[model samples]
Target: MSETKDTFFDFKLFKRLFKFIKPYKLVFFSLIICVVLLAGLSAAIPKLTEFAIDDSMTNKNPKDFVFYVTLMFAALILQTIFQLLFMYYASWLGQNLVKDVRINLFDHLLSFKMKYYDNSSVGVLITRAVTDMERIADIFGQGLFMIFRDLLTMTVVFGVMLYTNVKLSLIVLIMLPVLLYATRIFQKYMKKAFEEVRTEVSNLNSFVQERITGMKILQLFTRETIEHKNFKTINERHKKGWLKTVWYNSFFFPIAELSASITVGLVAWYGGLNVVLSDTVSQGVLVSFIMFIPMLFSPLRQIADKFNTLQMGMVAATRVFKVLDTTSHIDDSGNQIATSLKGDINFNKVHFSYVEDEEVLKGISFNVNAGETIAIVGATGAGKSTIINLLNRFYEIKGGDILVDGTNINQYTLASLRNQIAVVLQDVFLFADTILNNITLNHPEISEETVVEAAKAIGVHEFISSLPNGYHYNVKERGVMLSSGQRQLISFLRAYVTNPSILVLDEATSSVDSYSEQLIQNATDKITKGRTSIVIAHRLATVKKADKIIVMDAGEIVEQGTHDELLKKENGYYKNLYEVQFLQEKVA
Candidate 1:
């Protein structure tokens, strides 16, 4: 994140960014042409001034003055038109480039493995996708085109100054090295300052985002004052970062102005002597060079500013490209599509870990027949949910062979494989949208009538009817407006409408009210009727009617059988678990 660590000119990175703008090359290059023309016309203005001062004014000829005035006005008008085109097109190109890059960044994010998210911060990712992208777009708006236009103006001005008076141009050139050295020193300091600013921005955002997300927890613990103090500390650090940048700008601009003023004064002193000593030289030539001196140094001043713009953009681009360059996506090279799967799944000697050398599921094996309901009972972190994640291939197992209908899971295309499985998680997530859209998820293939039919079939239609708008009620972010049971019921309908061959109810009733729990129990019966269903439940009472119940401890399965069969085995894992786990649920 340190700016001094990065090169000012990253051609390779710009080359990568170029692809996004390549689609608009006609517009982009046309803008470049306009900038060049503008620069040329800007150079012509001083020459016309010299002509008006020395020739027409000295001769006192009104016709010559009038003709020169008309030509200068035409050039100024043409320059303005080119300037307009450059402004319009440059902004257009920048906005479009960032739009495409942001989409591409998000799409790449979607393909990453679950483990990537486990170790990364949501706030940092949000900054990269949003704030960092804005810095990049500014490259086109305030950086690239402006930088080029300034440089071209300086270059054209330089050549004209040399042609008009070689000695004055050389005198102005004396300040060039000193100005460049000062800029180098200033840039080095500001680069690190900008880096600190960006890092603090991410930190402040992460702290605020987490606190807001868990505001209820802070309130329950009565720690609002403590959290606010902590937030202020981070916010103060953010202020310090910005102040450092401001401090550098404070010292940098005045010195730059001093140097430009000194350089211009030297031009007047040296050029005036030449005007006195030589009969051939004109005061108008001195006047023209005096004007051209500022033009030459103006781009130099902007190079310092615009280079900062490009500097920030390259920094942002580096972070964005780092995300794009990740090789952490799940291997989705399998071409075999899973169409009409028989719902027979097998996990043979599966071993996996979220972190290296710390396995969560160790050499585990299981089989679910075509239409049997298997309930997995386990303590927290006993890897029951990990099984569901593995089955869906959210994380690649280190050593295992998972088969669906006798074919290895890796042999099936990821999208097709995931399409056949439906999961209603312990914590249901609903979008900030209508109840019906949350259920359908914009799946136009699943008609509105079909979703309504599925909801009623699951026995939760009465609940929906009681709501103000029935199915059309807006869930308003994570379904916070609805009761836990109501959200679970919506999840049920979502799963049913999809008609996935394999159904997973992971603690579907663990945190719901008794009324909604009963409805979910009834819906569970209907949803698991013919599919290969797996229920990971904390309450053993909820799994009594399951075709088979598997008990797990740590990372290994210790016992599994029918409920009645497991009840007879004294001191067995399932028998002991039934007493210990269910008693707690009853007490709560």
Candidate 2:
């Protein structure tokens, strides 16, 4: 969110963008050839006009007139061909370059730690990858090379004008300093205006995405009017930023046009005076000087507008590069692969914190043997879920080590390590796709038959098949078409299909109806029978069947024992928690 440097042009940013053109070097060089051809051909037509007037028309020869006209026609045809080639190849290169950058950015995002996502906005990232990427394409397709073409045309036009008549060319040159000064002023302010516009665009996207996603909560709390006002404020800011650019454009272009028109009038006056009095300037030279002046000034005018396009692209590139430069990704340097990993897990005096000074889990130690089921019970902030996060290496531990199969977890490759554990969380998320695809996540190796069999093993196949299209039914975004309990069932089926060595279910049954809870409990029992499982739940009855229970309080284990063994302790933490939950259940 930091603003890029305030400058007319950024050399480093341009060099970074230019690197994307390397793969298509042949096409790029071909484009340069087209640009040169177009500029040269366009400048020739005006000179041809002078030839037809001075030679063919002056001699009163019909055959010579026809010959020069045909030559002019051929030049026009060649100009058209090169112009077509220039536009096509420029667009093709722009699209391919943007495609590569978008892919690289997406891959970088996937490697980032969860902590980064926790602190960033989904909408801001979407704008960078989607909207801003299109602006970068404009830099190549319409902005950069088009400016080059115009400048080359102007150069040829000015040189030819000077060669033909020095006095008249000086008349055109007198206006150059004033127009160039105006263009410089316009370019500077437009860069700042465009930077502001890009910032406002990102803010608008983030605000709208957040509001729409949370519309249900807004309506439930009756915050519609207040939110509308907030949206108006942001929308107004976005509009004003654009208007400033428009204001600058409105003020600058007329000055350029007026300057060009006055130059033409002055040249005509000077040439007419010489023709009638001294016979110094010929009528053909006067006509061509008139044509040449506009050709010279037109590109100067367009350069200002195209330069704005280039500036906007640079601003976008700066932002995108900032994201690509982030170094917060997890280290995947561990050479160990977790192939055929045993289910044993050990957390030896592990410590962690999301914030620097506020520890969430302090000196936590525990062990689960292969094929053992353990339960963790605690209050909301007692670090129950923190333990699960660490086990999956979603975060790095501050101290001590977590071992899987007697080797430090950090030594195992992340992909290989995570492939061996499956998690089912309380709030499940499903994509807007068929239920079968949602379960398999479009994995090439996971087939529909495997998903169906997994659903049957968890005893949800009958429920799924009863719906329209059975497993192929679309669940819509975030599984909105299904109930909370049904989504939880899908999460379980998803995990079961993986057949992981370690299973972690965090509050998996806390928010379901009694019937759904019973169904989930049965599925849980069947899946955890032989797998090493760790269950965390607020409902004491759910964990009563665990092989061993570890009771946590204030980031430390207060008791470790089986169900009856913990209950036998005199006024113990587990005994108090169980008794309270039992009384609440009886009252309900």
Candidate 3:
């Protein structure tokens, strides 16, 4: 994400957001027009009061008084209609703009490379997508329109005050410079306060999200008190951030009121003096200034308050717009279409590093022919999983050429390439949905009957049938309703039903009961049948019948052979790994 610094406002960010509002230009302009007309009508109200007092009440002219009153009533009616239209159209424009912005951000997120997710916080992204978007929506829905209303009120009110009686107006204007200075100071400090508040809010959200998602682990380890203490610390910081903003608000509003009261006092003192001297100033003009002075000052006070909203909204816009402008996504420039892949895979001298200058995979190379099953065994942090990640183009290799059917993988569109390669990760992720939905993943073409048939072929149909709702059972969040082995079985069935040209399985190392093991082994056999398959081997017995076993150590391949042939070597890497990591599985 691009960094956001505290400024009174961010014009550049608004320029970017204005693009989303382009589609609703007519509605936005109409809202502006209504505000301008409302301001003019509103200014006319005080002038009507001066005319009614001077020409009707003082002179006792019933006809002139009735004329002014009737006109004021007409203005009020027009004002009400414009206000309604302004509100309705403003909301419509804001919601429509926010909808477009939300879709744009989500689409951009979908294109981001896996590397971005690896280093970013999910909670921060959630905050940006949801909370920040709402704040931005308020800019148009409430803040901006209110600001325009208040500003126009002040401008129109000031112009009439000067025109009606210049002497009283100048007396009232004496407080303007001081108030203006105060407003500038308020905007500066409040902008800083809100910037800090948003940061704290994001941090608090990230902490809470992680804690709730990992509540199971916290309970299992009995770390509730420890975690709660940590949460309190974060919560306190969040509260403090908001309190600072409130502090500035508390100080600023009272100062605004004090300034306005002083202006009123000056107007009364000077206007009363002129009347005592029998000067040209009329009583109606003095009273009009009294009424109009507050109108001007009230908007000034309100403008100060609404400017807070405007500033906060802009801060949120800064964050949301940054995401929309992000360029750290997969480059889908390749137009090559993949109708069918031959299942022939090759990695030639691939080099990669998750962090700069710290290689994870060092000059690794491998190949698998069509219809071959290759089992890869390795020690932890040995680049075994990285190879599979590269094959799917999840991460671009630092230096290497990965080809399928002799064409570079980069030459194919990511969608077309990934559609043909299905992977069943060790940590399976299932939506809080029914078993059937989890398997089919809402694919229109993949029917329930087809999913059930695939489950039966993989030998997991009996276990699924025994569940309370069978295929309709809701797994709950992250498949919490299912056991680890049961979830693994579901993952296997999910991959099997995909029927892709190539399959990649990150074998789970967790222990399972004998029954689940038998089901898994059978499912694995069916999925790997007649395809180029790569298995990150976790059990020696599971891969003993494989066509080849490749052993990796510290990003280098040190052993390559079938199970028996590798065991015959005295100090073969595969033999040592089998004894240490998978010996118990073989004994079982």
Candidate 4:
């Protein structure tokens, strides 16, 4: 993520944020009304004090004193009511907007191609969705309207001060430029500090998420000490980012305080000289001016602080909008739906690359007639998995075409196309959910009975039933409670229940024990009986029964034939690969 430049106010971002207000315009306007009332009432209280002291105290009139004090009390009550309304509605508006934005962001993320996930950090994306979104809520809750309210209150306070006595008002105005300059400097540096703080927060989240997820690997390699040191370094940088903001606050706030105190001192000195030397300024006016100076300065102080809040919110908004603005999603413009697919697949000179100009699949071509079983074999990074990804439209090919049922894959809707295929990947990911929910992925249409029947057909029903909760047992995160073979069986069961026309098992049987392998072999035979199946396996034995074997090396197919025919070519890629694996099995 790149740094968001330090900007005191971004009008475009503000305008974009206000667009969320369209849904809750009534609450927004009511909140505005409350803010206006609160500011007006707050400013009016001090004037009532000026009247109480001048008309009643100096004249020794008790009735006037009672009248003015009663009015001040009523104004205070009204101020409290409006303040409560302001806080509640402001928070309500902010939280609702956050909810909407968070949902949109998550939905947008779901639409992105697998290629996006390949390059982006999970932890960083999580921070943007969760932490950064919370910061945006502050824009409404404490930022824009609060700043406006303070400015309005200050305007009223200044008008009253000037009306009461021009000389004292002039004295108060003398210190304004010095304080304003200090605030401007503070606001500029604070924005930069906040940007650093947000950046460090994202870094910390990404580091922690990756570290926790890969903790097993870290421990297996005995890198605890090194990892601890690395974490400390990142954490220290996060601390320093925050400390910069603290330093700025500590420096600027005192300057604001001293300026306010000096203005009050100057007002009192000038007003006192008038009260004694001449009757130009009354003691009542002097007292009111004393009360008004802080009002004028307090808003000035709060405006700077609120501006910092506004900056932080805008920075967070910029990061979020960047994600929303990305066009990395696979095009879903095709309107054709894949229904009752015959499962005929053809890859016509397909070319693809994860990185620019470095092909992962180079002009790869193959054909699978309806209900035919094919196996792809190669060394690691031979682009075997890339074939499965393209088949499922998880990624778009750079050149050539992938056709399903004799129709170009791009012509079918992405969801409908993917629904016709079931892929059980090498690395199985299971949410922390019940076995039933994990198999059905919480689809309301798939019942427990259907899952059990599919499991029985796949030969894993007894294994799942033997668990503590039977079919309802929780798999935990990534099925950590189950052994590697058990997890693979669950993944196979998940695919079988989908009953897709085209089934893909990518190295599904490679990691299982002998017993699990036999069960998987039985399951494989049962599910692939009349469905188009593509199996990519490292073990030669697993692909021996495949209708056709396609040999791939680097990014291109080297050979394609039946198990017996491929071995007939003495120096062919498949013959050599089969010979090496056979020798390895003999050695074992």
Q: Determine which window of 10 residues in candidate 2 has minimal summed lDDT.
A: 1-10
Every candidate's lDDT:
0.86, 0.89, 0.84, 0.89
Per residue, candidate 3 scores C-alpha lDDT tens digits across 1-588 of: 233455555667778778888888888788888999999998898789889988999899999999999998999999999989888887788778888888888999998889999888889999999888888888888778888898898899889888887878788878988888888899888888888888998998899899999888999999999998999999998999999988988998889889989988888788888877977777778888888877888887777787888877888888877777777866677889875677999889999998999999888888889988989888789998998888888888899899898999889999999888888888889999999999988888899999989988888898899999899999999999998888888887887887889988887534556678778887777778898888888766568868888889888888888889998999877777778767876677
Clashes of 1: 0
Candidate 1 residue lDDT tens string, 177-203: 787787787778777777788889989
Model 1 steric clash pairs: none
TM-scores for candidates 1 onward, in order: 0.96, 0.97, 0.95, 0.97
Global CA lDDT computed for model 3: 0.84
Off by more than 4 A, model 2: 1-3, 586-588
Show the colliding residue pairs in model 4. none
Candidate 2's residue-wise lDDT over 375-465, tens digit each? 9998889999999888888888999999999999889999999999999999899999999988988888999999988888778899899
Better of 3 and 4 by lDDT: 4
Model 3, position 239: C-alpha lDDT score: 94
Candidate closer to the true structure by TM-score (higher is better), 2 or 3: 2
